[model samples]
Structure formats: structure tokens, C-alpha cells
Target: MSTATLNVRTGPGLSYPVLTQVHRNQTFSIVESKKDWYRISTDKGEGWVADWLVTRESTGSLNETGQQGTVSTNGLRLRKGPGTSEPVVTILNKGDIVSISETSGSWLSVQSGNAGGWVHKDYIDLGAHSSASASPSKNKEAKQGVITAGTLNVRKSPSLNSPVAGAVHRGNPVSITGSVTGWYEIQFGKSKAWISDNYVELSSTPVEVPATSSEFTGKITVNSLNVRSEPSLNGNIAGKVSKGEKYPILSERNNWFEIKLKSGKSGWIAGWFVQKTVAGEQKKSTSSTQPAGEKVTILHNGTNIRSSADVQSNVVKRADSGETFSVTGKQGNWYEIKLKDGSTAYVAGWIVSIRTGSGSESSPSRNTSGGIRNKVITIDPGHGGRDSGTIGTRGTLEKLLTMKTAQLLADKLKSAGAEVIITRKNDEYVSLPSRVSLSHYYDSDAFISIHFDSIYDSSVAGHTTYYYRNYQKDLAYDVHESLADRLPSRDRGVRTGDYHVIRENKQAAILLELGFLSNPAEEANVTSHHYQDLAATAIYHGLNDYFSN
Candidate 1:
């Protein structure tokens, strides 16, 4: 089977009782095939599994050592130990090739570059030793290409619906094997993986660098940024630098800033975390003074006003479109605004337009007929295909639950007069970037990603809502509070999270952790139609409440 553990059921559908779980790479004899389920003969007994959960591989066997496995799931965690309780050492992207050394139950001991750790065996595709190896001639003939996207996703297959295998940052060199419809099959490590052709550029020559002066200075903008031996995130960590630390800029690449270390050696830091400075200028303050009492209009609806200028700072209030605020001060990229209560707060400067005339125009009024009338909402069902997400004690799949909940939520939103767009309607894989792209593509007013949580300690169960940007905090809290009030579970409270989809989305985005599937009671409750309907209704009301305010 392709999954870490495939549930063995008594019948061919979800209605059947689960018998046991079969581990990944396990061989089985097919007895029969139903619509979307398969009846197979295992060593224990005859059991049924979902057809989409496993890949049909030719009859073969592999040796324990020296076997090669390709990562088939996006952002799969590599743990220090073999279980979920263990701390995550790093993340393996889809399309990453790993050398399999040993197998422990449903986990594999794999070596990807200099790191070695245990990953769920189900997310890996094991190949025979012969096919896994490449000849010297083939290696020499492989064409090279440079990644163009800030962070390009490597998939297990060519389709956008395929499971993510790994990721490559901009300027990273990759060996291209061939091309499909709109994707490039690349040779990553010892195995083959695919990436969208739109993000890769064919190159016969090396990356060109601009000539730079002898001395340039840079300052760290973020706290505790890691310095690496190479530009890539997978590179070895050389050291760390705290915020406000200044260093001599030695060179620059796509997203990496190479700086001269105190030891006279060179180290690379993420370009996003470093602010370049002039040869002799001092570090600039994050805040500045603006004309007092100058009014500005909020261009976007639901703009957040935080206690400070930083995105990680606490959000104090939300300003709606066309709402006017008095400018009190200014931060690096934020405008300190005076609220109606005479309190000062900061908003991102990019989302507001300064008003030169009298601030007499009132904010836009909401439709009383429906909470989200004419508003576009994008609903994202979390993992799918090969990414089963967290499996429950009773064999309930988080992916299946998320899809069901997303569909229910879409129906509720549509009934409330909102235009709903689902990232995926069925059991298919969609990358985090693709989901964010869909929100922007549809010009959605709000984006909500549906997911379930899992933990080693099953007793720790709750419902949570997460937002990345400060502007999304209200949406997160509104929906979270509504859902928490309706559900018979512990409230985990709203918090800031750094998820790729929410962090990169152009529109307001939030991720809802419905409940913990690891907990027996919560899993049963969350998977029921009654609970799903309650959640859908709560979200609908929350959207209405947020838009009304």
C-alpha cells in the first residue's frame, strides 16, 4: 500500500468496521475491486481498503539496505525518533529522494543528504535497486535548469493534483530528465521527481552574477536568523545571528545574502531576513514621526490595527474599507493611526490611502439580507491523495473529514448568498502555493483552509483557529469563537501561525483546526454529520458577523 498505514475494513466502504491497519510497502493479493475500495488478502485475513490509498505496483521485492525511496508527500516531517511524539528534525519536500537504511514498523530510517531521520513510510515510493540507479551516460546527458519561483514545489507526479514530493528555492540548480504537458521531470538525488515547467528555466550556462563593490553592509531584521554554509534551507547550519546584528555583505544570490563572518569566513542568510545598508549609513529606526492628526482612508476591507508595526505584534482592532483614521506616527512599513477611541495603533502602510481632504466619507455599508452577499470565499480541504494526514485510532482519515467538512461549509456559504470556491472538491492533492493562487485567482474576499489536528497524547483535544498576517486575526477569531461555542470540545483560542497558504495569500486567510482526530471522542464527534452541520452553520454566522462589523 502507498500510505503509512491503510485501514483494513470488513467491507469495501467507510461504513464497514475497521479490522486492522496494514503498513506501507506491504504486499497483498487482490481478491476483488469495488467502486472505490479494494478487497485484498493479507497475512492476517481478507480486508478492504480505499482504492485511491494505494498505488498498483508490479510484483517485486526490495532489500532492506541500499533501497531507494522517493518522498511522495509535501512537507513531510522527518522526526528524531520513529513516532509522532518525537521532535521534528526537518521537513522533506515532495520529490526528495532518500536512501532507505532500515524500516521500523510504519516508519523508515532514511538519509537525505547529510541528514538522516525517520519518516512515515507511506509517503515514500520504494523502487528496486536496479531502476533506482542511474548510468554515468544518463547523468552526463541530463539537462540542467534553474528554479525561478521563490519556492517551487516538487511533486510526485506531473499533475497539479499530485502529491508534493519536495521543494526547491529560486536559483537552485536541478537536473531535468524530460517534460510532460506543463511539468518537468527532474532527477532529484537518486530518483526522479516532477516540478511545474512554469517555475523552471532551461539553462546551459551558469547563473550570472552582477559585479559588486568591495564593501557593503547588511543588518538582520528578524530575531535569531540562522546562517548556513550554503544558500539552500537544506544546507548545514553554520551559526545564528540576532536582530540588529550588522555584517559585511560579501555576495548575494536569489534569496540568500552571503555575509562575512567575524571569523573571516563566509556564511549565507536568508535575504528576506536581512536589510541591506549603504557603505557608511547607520541602521534606520523601525518607526518614524508623521504629521499629527493627518487622516488616511483604509483601502481594503478588514485591515488590522496592531499594537506595534511588526506583523507578529498583537492586533488591537480592525478597520473597514473607506474608514478614516488619524495618522499619529509611522513605522518602517506601517502607519500609526489614531482610532475613534483616541487610542493609537499601527496598520500596514500598503493597505491604506492617505486622505488629503476632509475625512467625511463613511465606510461601506453591508447587505442586511445576507452576511456575505456577493463576497467570494475560497474553501481549502487540507490533505488528499497520498497525503492522508493524521489517522485516528479508529481508522478515520483526516483528509476525508476535511473534504466532507469543506463541502458542507461551501453549501452553507452559498446558501448565505456568498460565492464559494473550493480548492479541491474530491480526493485530490493541491499544493499550498496552488491553494493560495486559487484564492488570488478567484479574487476571494476570504480564504479558509479546513484541517484536523493530531497529537501523540490523545487526551489533548481542542478546536483552534490560526491566522498569519495581522489583518486576518479578526476573521480567525470570529470563526473560531463561533465554532468553539457550537462544538462540544475544548477551545484552543485563536493564535498566529506561519502556514504557507495563509502567510502568502494576497487576501485575508485563516486556517481552522476543527478538532483533534487523535482523541477518540473528538474523532467520533467531528466525523458525524450533526457536528459537521453545526460547524458549517457556525462558520456561516461568523462570516456574517465579521462582514457586518
Candidate 2:
């Protein structure tokens, strides 16, 4: 038989029914042949398939078709009809060969002897000598756009401030057009976004709002709140304000404020620290007042801690002589002490006798700062919950892999004398921005994100590291170099990336693509425990280098 390649045709026109996709190979049985059509016997029943898609044998047994090997991998669901949203009839498992009865718009109408429905040809491999090549058609390049606001962010996804892919300063234009969830879609303007929808914006030409200096009215809430020159905590403190005083909000910077106090002292306060009143004055919330609890006088000069635990780890700050506090509860040798400034601290139980009500039940040490241990190192295993990051071959989920590697890395870091803090301990998804926010919440010394890589071409494979901006390049290099040396796979070489989570982070950050999951060999290696340990070790060493330097 002169073997020929099969052409999975979609109707007469390629427009309405697009050639959805092609399988590597599949089988077929021809019952009747026409000029350009063949009525084939499928498991479902009789159906007409395009004759152009079949190659025949010289013996003429199946001059246009051949039977492919049968084995069960996944079941195929029967569709009500052809097209994208067709309803499923039922799922068919392997070992069952259905007859191909007809073809229309990329769908092959089939029958399993008695049962029948249409199946998208691409999903099932039909054994036929096909001359066609399986490759992705070139997609039109999407144009990027500019950031029209004072500052606009490119995210890991289309949502607000998703882990920042990169940032566009005021007036800088970007090439963005695609959109998802009310946000413009951008993939780092190229393949760099390996993750889709990594950049977003409202529209290409956003309505410009003039940057006019505006004043807001509100009351000061804290007794002695430090007013800063900028919104960030690191911003210079312009002055201090007394509680219950009124101020005019001069301008806004995210959650920070530019304000003028009633006493004519001008400065900025964290927006979260004050609430705007109806009269335009800012009012302090309950931040300045202490929570309800029985006051206590320490008997042994109570030492203030972060939680009600005496473990060397429990102490974040120490209470000095004459420090008064309200005893909220108690646990082994520790009391939950509330400071006069409304902040809660844990005090040593041996130094303070409960002067009032008993303390609350002692919770797990891990529940609150791990019950005062040594030092806590926060670890983020990146990507969870609805985000299906760069999918790899054979269904290796990045989220699962990252979590596993993170856990391993945490253990290694802990063994080296540091308490580990894991932002997420499960498979639940978390946004990139949230991951960064959580890192700040824990004040982690370093943050690492683990992930796998996927490429359109299966041949491209290796590992790489990414860092946002210049400050984190050293961290990226350390992790990348360590991974290259420790991992058992091929190194793609460490390169700089504008990943949002790493770039926007104020703390040291590094993201590692351990290996390309799309690459069969690399994918298998990444799934192995041995490789995971190597990855963990590399990351640990990288952190050590970063901190040591």
C-alpha cells in the first residue's frame, strides 16, 4: 500500500469549521468510497468521512484507510453535535474502536455499533498514514500598549496588581490589546510572560485624569502617629500628630496620604491608619485604643514577647521596667499581653502573674508565630487556587510541584538553623500580588518562588531563574547558579526576568523554573524526589549566599 498522510478536513470551507487540531496518528475503516467522500464503519454506526483524509493499501483491503493500535488511556466524551460548545453524550474508554461515519467542520460523526455521536477529530488519534505535519499555525502578533496613568502595573494575570510582571512609568506606552476580566492582557509583550495574561490594563487609551493636588478632610486617630513624606513606611517622617485632631487630606498615594493638620503641620499618614469622616476630616479608628482585657502588674519584670510562649523564639520585642499591660490570656509560662498602644504582645508567665481573668487556651505554636521559637523564615511556594500555571507534559501541575519543592526547601532552611514560614501549606491558589503582600506581612528575609517551564516547541528545554529589577539580580544569580550546579538536568543558564512578584518585592526575591515540564525527560526529572532535594539545596545555598553577603 502506498502510505499517505491523512487530512482531517472540516466541511468544504476551512472558515466555519476550522481544523480544530490534529492528533499524532489514528486508525480508520472505510465501508464505501465516493469521489471525495467515504462512508466509514465506526463503533457508533455508519457515517460519512472525507476521503481525502484516508490513505489506501495496494491490496485494496483499505486502499484509503488503516487500523491503528488500540489501547486505553483516557475516555472520549461523545458530543451532541460538532462545534465548540457541543453537549457531551457519554465518555468512551480505550479498547473500544468506534466507526467513523461522517465528517463536518472538524468533527467525525461516529457510531459504536449501536451508540453514536460526533467527536472532535483532534481528541482521538485515528490510525491513518498521514502526510500532514502537526504544528501550531503562526498567530498574528498582538500590539502592546502604554500605561496612561501616573503608574500602571503589568500583572501575572489580568486582575488588579497580580504579581507584577513589570511596571510602566507614567506616560510610557506598552503594546497591549488583548483583555481578560476587565484588564488588558499582556504577556510581557513577548514570550517572556511564559504565563499568559501576565499584563493587564483597562484599555489602550485610558481616560486621563489630570494629576491635580486635592485635599481630603479627616481626623487624626493615633495619639502620636508619624506622618511621612511618602506613602511607604520607609518614607521620611514629616512630623507627628496627636489623637482626635482634624486634618485636611492634601493628596493620595495608594494607601498613603499627604495631609495638613489643624495645627498647620503638614505630613503624610498611612491611609489605612485613618478613616475619612463625612465632614471631610480624617478620624482615627480604634487603632489608638487598647482592646478590652484585665490590666496586670508584672511580679518578675515581665518580658514582652510576640506570643504567649516562653520559647526563645517567642520574643520579638522586650518589655522594659514599669511596662504595664492587660493580660488577655495565658499558656505555658506565657501570657497574652496587650500593650497600651493597642498592640498585643506575649509576656513571660514566670515574670507576670495574671492580675485579672485567666488567659485564653494555648493554641498550637505554629498557629501564632510557631509559639515563640528561634527565628521564622517565610517561604512562598507560588501559584495556587484557580491559577493553572505553565502546564507540563503528562499533567505535572506547577502548583503541586512548587508546594512540594517549597516544603522541601523549608525543611532544608530550618535544618540550617531558621524557623520557616510557609505562606501556603496547601493546593489552594493565591494571586502573585497576594504572595508578595504575604511576604511583607511575615517580614521574611527572603522569598523564593518555584515553578516549571512550558514551551510551544517540545524540543526547547532547560532550567532558568528570574529576578525583577536590579536589586534582586544578585539573589537570582545565586539561586540560578546553585540550581545549575545542584540540579541533575540541563541548565538553560540564569537570565533576568521582569516577574511581578519578584520585581515589586521590597525584600530579596528569586523565582526558579526548575526545568521544562514540556520536555519529557526534564518533566520526569522534576517529578522525582531526588531532583526536588537538589532544587531545595540549591535554593537554600542561594539564600545563604544572599544573607551571608
- Give the winner by TM-score: 1
Per-residue error (Å), model 2, residue 147: 54
lDDT of 2 by residue, 1-549 (tens): 112433333343222243333332445565554434555554445555454344433333212222222223455666767765875544455544554545666766654422356676776566541222221112333554433233344444432212334344332334443532224444342323211221222232322222223433455656678888677767797788777676666666655667876667677886544644223111211111222455544432234456434232455666554455766543322456667677776664423333333444332222322222244466777677787677776688888888888987775454344667787889897777888897788777767777888886554567888877677778788768767765546788767777887877887777778888776545766787656765776676666656555
Local accuracy by lDDT, each model: 0.70, 0.55
Candidate 1 lDDT score at position 470: 85
Per-model tally of clashing residue pairs: 8, 66
Question: Which residue runs does candidate 1 get wrong by more than 4 Å?
Answer: 1-369
Off by over 4 Å in 2: 1-376
lDDT of 1 by residue, 1-549 (tens): 544878999998766898888998877876765655788997779989886668754333322554666788777777777899986655576766776765667888776543467898889887433243521111223566656455666665554434444456554566787764346788653457777665564555433222235344677867698999998777799999999888878777755889988888889998756655333323221111233345777654566678975444687987777797777654333567778888888876545566533544332222321457678999999999888989986789989999988887776465345789999888888888899999999998899999999987665677889999988988987888778756656799998988998999889899999898876556766787656756776776677677777
**Candidate 1 lowest-lDDT run of ten:** 280-289
Residue 462 accuracy (lDDT) in model 2? 71
Q: How well does candidate 2 match the true structure in TM-score terms? A: 0.34
Q: How accurate is candidate 1 locally (lDDT)?
A: 0.70
